[model samples]
Target: MQVTGFVPRETADLRGRAGGPLTLRYGPRAVVVVGGLPGSGKSTLLRRWDAPATLIDPRTTRLACQARMPAALPYPAYRPAVRLLHLLRTRAAFRRPGPLLVHDCGSRWWMRRALAHWARRSGRELHVVLLAVRPAEALAGQRARARTAAPRTFRLHVRRTARLLAGIERRGRAAFPGARSVLLADAVSRGRLAGVRFDAPR
Candidate 1:
């Protein structure tokens, strides 16, 4: 159960129970959906897992807009259209056989439905990881990250991002009742996931 290189910074201390090499009981293709507030370490976990995953990040699009356009548009104004396009493109690209695909985005109900529909059609297993950190911790992380990277208005942007994630989670749970969901920190602390097929890097 030793996750080895697959544990994130927040989960490093919890890796003392590291066991033998990791193995998965199931062999089906998977779709890992990661959801959390702005600074819940979703990107860290995604990189650690190192699965064949597609990262559909709304923030990237916002950054792109700021880079390409003269006027910096707010993330809220541009995210929906960009997300829709990404979803359509992802569905098209994933029509063929490949490794597990992970969607690293806010877990909104509509987005979950789109993902689940693709999974069901492709006969792929779906695993949802919800990163939940304390509000204060999350805010602190957001502030620190914003200091280095944000384009404009750090505090307001972080607050909006947190609110957006909360709404997405609220909607996602109501929509996808059967998908496996776990808190990022808690799941890592537990060492191994229960229902999902998680294999170590080979």
Candidate 2:
């Protein structure tokens, strides 16, 4: 698997410290999974990419639900349904190919394995862009966005994100063996990410 510079340091923010923007190109039938803790700026980076891809993000599902339901309802009450819908949409998007970007919490090992398996079986390549943001920064991002997870959930995400980072540091390419992985090493900014795009290979 191809990798950009830096094997990911434990407890490091992936926005600024990492070298230049790491670009990974793939066939038009590939899917790119952007994984990180909430508020790690996955959506922000996707916007920077500005490429044509199926974007699978839970927040989009939440906004759609909010339109039909009361905004006063807590997210926990609808999270299960939202996740189910997101999964269904992901399944459908994978059927049609161009390029796909999936914004996801990188905590689920089983789901990652499943995606790896599917990519292998379908003869499509899967790539991962891991944003290793520190937890405090992630919380700040949540606060900035005016939506935050419950304390317990936030802690869980922190733990899982830390673990993923640790694995990346320890195992390098083996950590995410199924795909070519790119690690953004510090907090991201518009200036830092300028000229970044995930163009499909011709």
Candidate 3:
């Protein structure tokens, strides 16, 4: 059987991943990818984030698909189309000059590998912003939002998220092998991450 990835000791020791102050260390021309499970504040954080960067989010594509499609049609039915559009848009944006801040689902290894490869090939620094919200809190956040994920989907996300966190704790800096930081919902609410600023274009 194929084995899953393992986390290194140092990456697991990051204080930020444990709800402590996030460390921000980056070089010029960096692409920061924000990732987390559903309702883990990835979207919420990016919406208010601003920096000298291009934002790539699949939700925009999904929303555009919703606008052009029938209201009664279920989102899951058209998700493939939305994802295709998002991929197209992302590929196009990858060629553009400037830093990029990508909102992503961290559950997929392929997505992470792609971003890492692109950053390496382009001579750009790659950074990961991981949202580390608890499963129960993430579920609560889904309810607080106007749209909620299906229960089964949410459960799947929770399982993947748990594994991701475990990997981070076990792997250390090598967990992502690039600049990495973690954000906890509770910590953000308490103003613990006041030093870090991520602004979105107005």
Candidate 4:
């Protein structure tokens, strides 16, 4: 059997958040959810994790969909298809026998609930790693990546993400229902993380 692993000091990051090179040992039977505002470097964090787990990233699904669609087709034209496809893929990914990594913008309650349900049914802990960055910094990240959300959409993400961050700070674990715990990581701390390790806690 596997169990979540974190020393008392590390628990502060899991609850309070960031500091040094992170070595999270949440177990291979974990559903690690990485969330943040649009362009908040959720993707970067996942990419840096460099784990061998099944990664359920909507951006990857979107790019796959775009590759098959006509070059003239805009993303909005097939956004629903991409969402459905990504959802299906995520559902399928959970069936595998190891840690599952996913990225989100932190505004979708239904999605998080569904993920939590799946994790519980599979006897896995649902761990959330939320990237908390300033809205200006997030937008700058968006620019750095050369792929930005629509202005209105970004503004909405900012408001929702801000509210979510606040709730986590004020209410702690209560803010994220069903999640075993949450890690609030800033850019500097997250940047220092070498990678994630999932295995039986010793």
Winning model by TM-score: 4
The model with the greatest lDDT is 4
Summing lDDT over every window of 10 consecutive residues in candidate 4, give the lowest-scoring window: 2-11
Per-residue lDDT of 27-131 in model 1, one digit per residue for the tens? 335556666555656665555555544555555555665676546666567668776766666686456564454545443556667777887777765555655
lDDT, candidate 4, 1-202, per-residue tens = 2333342112235333444555566676788888888788888787777887888889899889999999998879999999999998988888889888888776777887788777777778787888787788888999999988899998888888877877777877567777777877776666655577777463
Q: Write the per-residue lDDT of candidate 3 for residues 89-177, one digit (tens) a residue.
A: 87677678867878887767667777777777777766676777677767777778867878888787778767777776676435564
lDDT of candidate 4 at residue 32, scale 0 to 100: 81
Tell me each candidate's RMSD, in Å, in order: 7.3, 5.1, 8.4, 4.1
Each prediction's number of clashing residue pairs: 0, 10, 16, 0
Cα lDDT tens digits, model 2, 47-93, are 87776677888789878987887879886798899888877777777
A best-first ranking of the candidates according to their lDDT comes to: 4, 2, 3, 1
**TM-score to native of every candidate shown:** 0.58, 0.79, 0.76, 0.88
User: Candidate 1 local accuracy as lDDT?
Assistant: 0.50
- Local accuracy by lDDT, each model: 0.50, 0.68, 0.63, 0.76
Clashing pairs for model 2 are 13-185, 13-186, 14-184, 14-185, 14-186, 15-186, 15-187, 15-188, 16-186, 16-187
In candidate 4 the C-alpha lDDT for residue 57 amounts to: 88
Q: How far off is residue 141 in model 1, in Å?
A: 1.9
Model 4 deviation from native, Cα RMSD in Å: 4.1
